[model samples]
Target: MAPGIIEMLIVGFAVGLTGALAPGPTLVAAINSTLKSGWKAGPLVTLGHAIAEIFMIVFILTGLYVFLGEYSLFVVIVGGIALIVFGALTTLDAKNASVDLSKSPDNAGNPVVAGIVTSASNPYFWIWWFTVGSALLLTAVSGGVIVFLAFIIGHWAADLGWFTLVSTGVHRGRFLLKQREYRILLTACGFFLIGFGIYFLISGMNL
Candidate 1:
């Protein structure tokens, strides 16, 4: 038997958390904003991320779905390769990255806009939407719009939960996430992405 709405939701949440934990521009922005603006930045950034995702979801559902359906294998292969490259780059970046709270911008604009712009500017964001995200949406759609909506909610919930936790911890604990801890966390996330990328590559080849 096929999975139900709950299962899809769980899948969505897992995927979202994985994506959020991965070191990326948006994650950087979230951390930066939080240091400057406090814990409130977390939710605001997520809200903006969600807004950007909403439009992306709609576009994938309506227009990109057709093209993806036609070239599914090719798209998956390219996406998988891209993921591998991204993983490598992330790993390298983690080794050198340092979080200097002292450098936090004093004039960082609205967190919501920061979220939207950061998300939009990232090429990987669109790439994931086209490949992994599109595939996930197709699965969710099998159960109906409501199920798909639930998947979206689950995904955003992970984003919100993670960013909020990070922001709150940074704001409250202040000394919890040192540069070494940050690098370790990002390195772990990079490995995760690499694992996922390998899986995607294998799956694409099988197709």
Candidate 2:
């Protein structure tokens, strides 16, 4: 049986939170931007992230549905490979990154642009949309359009909440989150990405 709207929302929120917590370009960007600006950076970046997600949701709900429905395996393979490459690149970048807030600008660039570009470049973002996201979307469609909308709202809420907290904490306690700590976190996230990438590759091969 299909899950109800409430259940769908809960599931969406949980999944979204899980995705958000995972170390990725988006998280790194948020932290870096917040360090330069303030807590407001978090929400601004999230706004861009949310916009990208909204576009993906619409595309999935529309004509992409037919493509995914028919060529599911193809989509998986492509997405999986993309994840692997992205993961490797992310790891390398993190390893060589310099965390120097001293040189950071008061206002680097538009958070919205940062969010959009960061999100658009991240391969794992698309992978999630193609895999877990696609599953949630299918379930939501089964329940109803209202359920789908609920899922989107719940997911985005998680993103906004988590990033807001992160940015706020960083902005308030910048000294606590020093350069070394930031690099460590970035490195950890990079490894996590690589692990997820390997999993995706295997899953794709199996498919």
Q: TM-score for each prediction?
A: 0.74, 0.67
* Residue 74 shift from truth in candidate 2, angstroms: 12
Cα lDDT, all candidates? 0.77, 0.70
At residue 62, what lDDT does model 2 achieve?
Answer: 86
Steric clashes per prediction: 0, 0
The C-alpha stretches of model 1 lying farther than 4 A from their native spots are: 1-25, 28-37, 131-154, 173-175
Best by TM-score: 1
1-207, model 2: which lDDT tens digit per residue?
444788768756755765665566677677878877789988998999999987988888786677676765665556556545544655566555543333354445777778888898998788778765775576577667888888888888888987887788778865345556555665565565556546645654565
lDDT of 2: 0.70
Model 2: pairs clashing at backbone N, Cα or C within 3 Å: none
